[model samples]
Target: MRFVPLVLAALLLIAGQTAAARPPSAVFLNVVAHQDDDLLFLTPDLSQTLKASVTVYVTSGEGSHPESMTPEDYAEMRQAGERNAYATMAGVANRWDRVALRTGTGTTAELATLRARPSVKLVFLRLHDWSDLHGLWNGEVASGGTVLPTGSPARVEDTYTRDKLTKTLTWLMDHFRPTVIRTQNPAPLSGFYAPDPDNPDHTAVARFTNLAAESYEGKAQVRNYRGYDDAQLPTGLDPALRAERTKAFRAYADVDTNVATLFDDTASYLGWRQTMLNRWPSGVSWTDGADEAYAVLGDEVKRWRRNVFGEWGKPVGLGGSGFAPAVTVARQADGRLRLFSLNRNTFDVVTAVQDRFGDYSGWTSLGNPNGPGGDQTGLPAAGTDAQGRLWFFVRNGGGGVSARQQNADGTFGDWQDMHGWGVQDGLSVVSAGGRLQVFATQCSARLYVTATCSIARLVQGESGFEWDTSVVPGAAATAPTAVAGTDGKAHVYFRATGTAAVLMAVDGVVTDLGNPGGPGEVAATATGEVYARNAAHGISARGASGWRAVGGHTEASPAVVGRGVVSIGVDGRLTQLVH
Candidate 1:
């Protein structure tokens, strides 16, 4: 008890102070439900943490792979592996140490319960193993875990409790007192925790994180990072190992999964490369889920994955298939978030209930019996309009030829073939200065933000869809970003090409805000006072003057908040861009 008083208080002070530091801003405590889980959902985040040298705490690696070993032997080997893994991840053991401690349960468990405890300065957290079983990832049936029933997707131990984990976690926090903490979001988990069965560990982690950070209130930020999706890993024992290393990076990096551009590097370049090869001894596994994985991802994207491997023996493939259904995610004029979707043959609004009741579809959409891209136009970018009619920028995907439709009324529109313009992101459909403003990317990879009255073209057969274009002349945009500004102007930025892979921003005035280029899209910001994303840096705005790199770095598309915007970067760290 006396130790608690002294140690806990010290932990809190250190955690708080560490958060306010210059760059390498915050410290982190990772409470992954399983070993490989963090690798899947939290990879980039880890990269960012490592870059900042933030301390990490890991748990659960014993029970998983152990299904293959006796409890005693398995625990010993797994603990050794865990130690090796963390040591490799943090880059040093003098600054990092592995301790056998039970996490969620809080109460001291036997040595077997201890998983990962790093001794980096200014950090404290329980790295207790839920079961080393955390190494095995599952959830997606098509990805193959549906049948392999021996690992973590099958967590069967309750040796711990919320109360137990809380006491210990709180003690760590009181000790570390991190002003900004991280955990997985447990609320409305789509694949599992459906309608609240509540056996999952996320809820526990979130609840605990909430409680632990409560005393700090507005004084702190308890960010919820997405845990891994073992459901998506390629089926391979070595992939399992490699996956852990990836997770370590992403969790530290903090970027969204769908959009992050993975710059491939030799496995050896990462610390885990040599160690994983030495320890796990790759190229061996009981099951082969690669084909099934290829089947799920389809061919084109699989080709992208294949391109990365080159001719590396038997190539892994997710097969060639289009993509899953496109769901509309945008706020409606009626003050509710709606998801309009059509898959298979069903068509309807996706269930938009949010944390209000039970047995609810987190987001269910009925497919359009009329086919996905009905008529000449199919799916549209979900954007809200002036009158609040949600705009759907439908694309045929054959090329830039797409149409616009309104979800409130099933009635659709004709298609507009902007053949050369490959639509980037649906930035905005603002009716600021008379006509509707449309901004997107060109097939040539330049920025294009138009003040067009194209809504009528999609609805009618008229030829004139007022499209005004502004290109950065010769700027070859690797990843383009555009957003509307409160100053009555639209701004566009893109990752530059060739020698200066820098990101550049240009104000799509009826003119120019001048032009400036930088190092990474991770450094650019949207053009004005209204900010949409909290973690985006690759997209920034130059005032009537010049450069202010938005936040640290983010991958999610930027969206303007009412006044201030949450900017997320490739690094996944976020800052508010307050006008």
Candidate 2:
């Protein structure tokens, strides 16, 4: 690690103490080329993780699309616009304090600290635009943000090199040590090396940010969002969310723009020119068109470290193989972790096993449920029965739930159909009350459908698993998460389709717990406490006092181990939380 100067360290420590009495569960650093990149392309995600975030603009918002205003006025207006938009999402007044920070190379940057959430910050580097840096290739490899004098207002201070830019970003990482990093997508190399479909600044800034992350030795979960083309695609937000987004964008445009903006004009500008794109990097797949990434939990073969409380083992490994982005893990009574994943390219079901000592036996393929050339979709779920046998549930190629079990002797059983349709992956099975309960989300209008994709429940008795095909209230969308709480009642949690509120259904009664804004999984300790990952990617548990934001950032659905909850983090590592 790079050494921190005594003065700088003291300042950082003081700032940390004053920012929040308790450290933020996780910090997110968002680096972009100009203003509004995050607001434009990274929605719900940016809003979801704004609790402790920093948005860094590499170039001043000036120099692009010149109008009657002076360069300085345009720049200040853009910054003010961002402040208004961010303040709306953050639920605070538009107030911030400015601080001056210097990179290791002595290059200065402007840091704006939120008045309400001091931990949340904004940094501006004021680099040149894409046009000035275009065609200045160093041996067919073009680089931006490395040098000055090509354009930008900051040119008088110094010219940068790729190495210097990397070093500067490294300085930011050293100071913030973000748990998550968001940047624009870097266009991948193609056979013909086609021109980038996004803004050159977006691509360049992303490349520099990625390289800086690579040079930094510390761990940080990173994701890339689509750039300019995002606005041209379908609006990722629902009507309600789209309206909320319009208000935010309107606030941005009204901030010092002084132009009378009609509601229709603002809405049009947002929908037609600044909407969020639903695509992400392949490893980080989007969920139902939303931007949060997911991984299979409890996959076998990854190493798991014990939690800080030594209550459960931490997960280790990069999760399951293949291009599929989702995975689900189940903990067996024997203290083993069974991971189930889908092969997006091939639709094969993959399984891996992890032993008590944290050793993985590698991944094993179970072949496709529909035989060769089968097309499968959605995520798979796993559970264990009272007999200690593992059960894997998947949305079979035929659009119905299928199941197979591991015999007591550890042998595999033939796949069996769990008939009743309306299945689209996102399966959750739990052994409760001496019976195995299977839950899934069903399309309302399709085969075995309802009005919308509603929650469906099936119970396995001595006669075998049977579906009620009845819709669970408040579970009008996505998958259902079931856990037997400490109260001795089985609870099912689901996001009410349109509202995104997490509704807890127990014994036919459902309570709205507000929107978690992300997919959730259920885990329960032996003591009966229920836990799930909150919208901020932190662990939260339902106790007598209600839901509390526990710490940790995870990308996988949670599984229970003893009294602790464990899930995969964005770094493809395991994170555990125990009371």
Among all candidates shown, the one with the greatest lDDT: 2
- Per-residue accuracy of model 2 over 1-579 as CA lDDT, tens digit each: 111111221222112111223335567788888777777666556776677888888776566534676666566666667777788888887777655555666776766677887777888776665543222222233444422211222333445666666677767776776767778755421111124446677766766776677655445655566664432333323455556566666667666353225334422244333334322212111111111113432221234444355543443455443324455666666766566666543667877665677456667778766886565434567777766777877776556788888876665699888876646446766677766788876653221111345668877777777886653654354457776566655577765654555577777787776543444344544355666656565767777767776677664446655555555555555555653
Error of 1 at 189 (Å): 6.7
lDDT of each: 0.32, 0.58
Query: What overall lDDT, based on C-alpha atoms, would model 1 receive against the true structure?
Result: 0.32
Residue 303's lDDT in candidate 1 = 13
lDDT of 1 by residue, 1-579 (tens): 000011111111111222232333344445444333334434434433543323333343333332445443333333333333344565543122222233332333212111233323212232334421122121211110111111111122333243444455555554443434555544312221123322245444544554545433122233443322222111112233345456444432232221123423321123222111000000001001121111111111111111233221222332222222222345555544443332211222222322333112343343332345332123334554455555544333332434344556543444335442433222223333333444443332211111111111111113433444443343332223334445554344433332223233444222323333322222222334422222122445444455455553543334333333433333323333443
**Candidate 1, 343: how far from true, in Å?**
27
Model 2 scores worst on lDDT over the 10 consecutive residues at 283-292
Per-prediction TM-score: 0.39, 0.54
Task: Give the Å shift of residue 497 in candidate 2.
Answer: 4.6
